[model samples]
Target: MGYFVPVEPGVNLFVEDINQEGSKTIVFIHGWPLSHKQFEYQFNILPALGYRCIGIDWRGFGKSDKPISGYTYNRLADDIRMIVSTLQLDNFSLVGHSTGGAIAIRYMSRYSGYGVSKLVLIDAAAPTGFTKETAKDLLKETLNDRPKMMQGITDTFFFQYITSSFSDWFFQMGLEAAGWSTAAIIKLLRDEKLDADLPKIDKPTLIIHGIHDKVIPFAQAQELDQKIRNSQLVPFQYSGHGPFWEERDKVNQLLTQFI
Candidate 1:
C-alpha cells in the first residue's frame, strides 16, 4: 500500500510512512548500486510495531533521477536534509546499510542530529581503511570509458560476498532497479570517506554486521563500535553482507531491541 511521495526532484527522493499515522518514523537508506526496494522487506513489514518506515533512493539510484552530476557525498546528504526538514519529522530514527550508513553518518555529523534520534547501521561502511589506493587504481581504468554507461556492475560487484541463491537477485535485479552507472559507481567508490566524521556522532547507534561479510568486512563494524561513543555492535555468525536478507528473523529481533 505505497505510492510515490515526491520531492524537489534534484536527487529524486521517495518517501513512505504509516498508513494512518505514526509518532515515530524509521528512515531506511539503501546501499550503493541498490534502490530503496532492497529494503522491500522492511517497508512491507515492521508496521506491526506501529512504525512509519520510509526508505529513500539516493541520487543515481532507485526511482530517484539518475543525473550525470551531483554525486558527491555532500550533495546526496543535502538532498536528504531537505527531505527530513520538508516532512517536518521529529524524533525520527534512521537505518542505513553499507554506503547508506556512510551517508547517514555524514549527515548526522554535519547536522548534529536535527530530526534523527536513533541510528542503526547494518554492515556499514566506515572509511578507516577505505583507502584511496585501491580505488585510485580501479578509477584510473574507469577513466578510459565513454560518457554514457553500457555495462552492469553486478557481474563482479559482489564477487566475494555472493552465493548461488543470493547471486541472481541482489546484484542483478536489485541493482538494476537502482539505475547506477559504472562511472557513477566508480566515482562513488573512489572519492568518499566517512571515517573523518564518525567520531562526532552524539546519537545512539547500532552497528550490525555479518561475520562472513566480505564486502565491507566485520572489522569495519568493530571499528565503528569502538569509535562511536553511544554505539553497540551485533554480529551475525552465519550471515554475509546482507544480514537482514540472510537471517531476517534474528535481524528483526536485534532491530526491535535497538530501536
Candidate 2:
C-alpha cells in the first residue's frame, strides 16, 4: 500500500508499505536523486519473504512534496521521525542507501535510534569529506545541465551491465526530482559531517559497501565499521555504488539473515 504521510505543514512524504502483516518490518530510505522506487528489487523479494517493507520517498524527490527549504540532514531525519511515530513503528530494521544512509545516521543520533532494532547502510555516504570547490562545481553543473550531470552519475553508478532501457529508467528517476532539491542535497552532502553521530549508534549495524564504489570511497565504509561499535562491514566486490541493485540477491540474503 502507498500513501502520503505528513511530516510538516504542507509537506507530506510518499511512503510505500508492503506486506503489512509480515512478522518483521524493514524501513528503507533511498539515496540522493532517487526515491523509494530505488529499492524496487528489494521490495519485490522482501515482501514475499514475510518482511514488512516500508520505503519512503524523501521530500523533494519521488512523489513527496517539494519545498525550497528543509534539505538539511536534521530536518530530513525529523521527517523520518514523524513517519515512525505516525505509523507506530517499533523494533524495526532501518535500511538506508547513499545519501539516505547519511540521513539514517542523523536519524539514529537525533532520535536516539527510536523504535529501530537493527541498522543497515548500503553503500552509504557518511564519514565523508569533499572540498568546497568540488561541491560548488557539482552544484553549478547540476543547475546548468542536470541531464548531463545525471548521465555522468548513471554511467558510474554500476559495475555490472545494465540494459539500455534499464539505464533510461534509472536516469528518468533523477529527472523526476526537483532541480532545487537536488542541488540542495548536493550542498548537504558536501557540508554535513557525521563523525560525531557514528559513535552514538548503539544498534547492531550492518554496513554494506561496494569495494569499487566511486561515489563514496570504500574507506568511508571502513571508517564507519571502525567507529560504530558492534557494526559489521560487508564488502560487495562485484559492485559499484549501487550494490543493492547490482547484487540484489546477495543483498537480499544478507538482509534476511541480518534483520
Candidate 3:
C-alpha cells in the first residue's frame, strides 16, 4: 500500500509499504536526489519472499512534501524517527543508500537505533562526503544547470551497461526533486560529519559498496566497516555507485543472507 504519513505539521512523507503482513520488515531509505522509487527492484522481489518492504521518500524529494527548510541531517533523521514511531516499527532492518546511509548513521546515533535490529549501508556516503571545492562546484552546477548535473550523475551511476530507457528513467527521478533540496543536500554532504556517529552503532551492519563507485569511494565503506563494531564489508566488484541496480541479484542475495 502507498500513502502519505505526516512526519510533522503539514509535511507528509510518501511511503510505499509492501507485504504488510510479512514476518520480516525492511525499511529502505534512498540516496540523494532520488526517492523511494530507487528501490523498485527490491520492492518487486523482496515482498514476494515474505518480507515486508517499506520505502520512504524524504521531504522535498519524490512524493514527499517539499518544504524550504529542514534539510539538515538532524532534521532529516528526526523525520525518520517520526515515521518509525508512528508505524510502531521494531526489530526491523534499516537499509540506506548513499545520502540515505548517512542519514541512517545519524538516526542510529541520534535515536540510539530505536527499532532497528540490523543495518545495511550501500555505497554509503559516511565518515565524510565531499570536499569544499567539489561541493561548491556541485551546488553552483545544480543552481545553474541542474539537468546537466543530474545527467552527469547518471552517466557515472552504474559501471555495467544500462539501457537508454533505463538511464532516462533514472535521470528523471533526480529531476523530480526540488532544486533547493538538491543543493542543500550537497551542502550537507560537504559539511555534515559522521565521524562520531560511527562507533555508536551497536547493531550488526552489512556494508555493501561497489569497487568501481566514483560518487562515494570504496574506502568510505572500509572506514565504516572498521569503525562500526560487528560490521562486515561486501564489495560489489562489477558495480559502481548503484549496486542495488547494477548488481541487483547479488545485492538481494546478500540482503537475504544477512537479514
Candidate 4:
C-alpha cells in the first residue's frame, strides 16, 4: 500500500509503504527528476530479504502532490520528518540517491537521527552543494532549454555504452518530473550549501559513488567521507552517475551488506 502523508494543508507527499513483518526498515529516496519508482531494484528485493522498504516520492516529484513552492532542502527535510513522525518509524535506515542524498543529509542534521539509524548515500550529491560557477552556468543553461539539457544529460552522463531502452527509461523519468520542480531544484542546488550539516550526522554512514559519474563528480564522495567522520566510501569502477542502475548487482550486494 501507499500513503499520501500531508506535508502542508493541501500538499500530500506520496510514500510507497512496502511494509512487511519486520523491525528494521529502509526508506528509499529518489534522485532528481525521478520518484520512488526509481528504487524499483530495492523495494521488493529488500522486503524479501527480511527488511521493510518504504520509498518516498518527494513533494513535487513522482506521484506526490506538485506544490508550487517548498522545493528547498529545508522544506524537503521537514517533509521527511513528517513522514517519519506519521509512520512512527524507529531504528530505520535512510537511503538516498543523487540529490536525495543531500535531502537525507539535511534531514539527519535537522532531526539528529530521530527515527533514523543508518545512512546510505548512493551516487549522492552530498556534504557540499552544487554551488560552483560551472554548475551555476549549467543551471542557467538548463533553465533556458530543458529539452536540450536533458538530451545532453542522457548522452554524456550515463555509462558510454548504455542501451537504447535504458537511455529511454532515464529520459522518460526526467520528462515525468514536474518542470517547475526541476527548474527550482537546479537553482536551489546552485545556491544551497550543505557543509555545516555534514558534521551533524553521527550515525553509521556509507558513501557509495561511481568513478565515472559525470553529473556529480566522484571527488565529492571523498569530500563527503572526510566530513562525515567514520563514513565509508565505495567507488563503482564501471559505473556513472547511476550506479544503482549501471551496476545493479554490485550496488545491491553493497546495500544488502551495509544494512
Give the number of the best model, judged by lDDT. Answer: 3
Report the CA-based lDDT of candidate 1 relative to the real structure. 0.70
Q: What is the TM-score of each candidate against the true structure?
A: 0.82, 0.98, 0.99, 0.93
RMSD of 2: 0.9
Give all candidates' CA lDDT scores.
0.70, 0.94, 0.95, 0.84
Q: What is the lDDT of candidate 2?
A: 0.94
The positional error of residue 201 in candidate 3, measured at the CA in angstroms, is 0.4
Residue 150 displacement (Å), model 1: 12
> How many clashes does the backbone of model 3 have?
0
The candidate maximizing TM-score is 3
Assess the local accuracy of residue 209 in candidate 2 as a C-alpha lDDT between 0 and 100.
95
Q: Is candidate 1 or candidate 3 better by lDDT?
A: 3
Error of 1 at 90 (Å): 1.1
By summed lDDT, which 10 consecutive residues of candidate 2 come out lowest?
A: 127-136
Clash tally for model 2: 0
lDDT of 4 by residue, 116-210 (tens): 87999988876555667856665765678777767776887667488889778877777776778887888777788889999999999999988
**Candidate 4 to truth, TM:** 0.93
- On the 0 to 100 scale, the lDDT of residue 46 in model 2 is 94
lDDT of 2 by residue, 1-259 (tens): 9999999999999999999999999999999899999999999999999999999999999999999999998999999999999999999999999999999999999999999999999988897645588678779889999998889889999988999999999999998899999999998988889999998999999999999998889999999999999999999999999999999999999999999
1-259, model 3: which lDDT tens digit per residue? Answer: 9999998899999999999999999999999989999999898899999999999999999999999999988999999999999999999999999999999999999999999999999999998998899898889999999999999899988999999999999999999999999999999999989999998999999999999999999999999999999999999999999999999999999999999
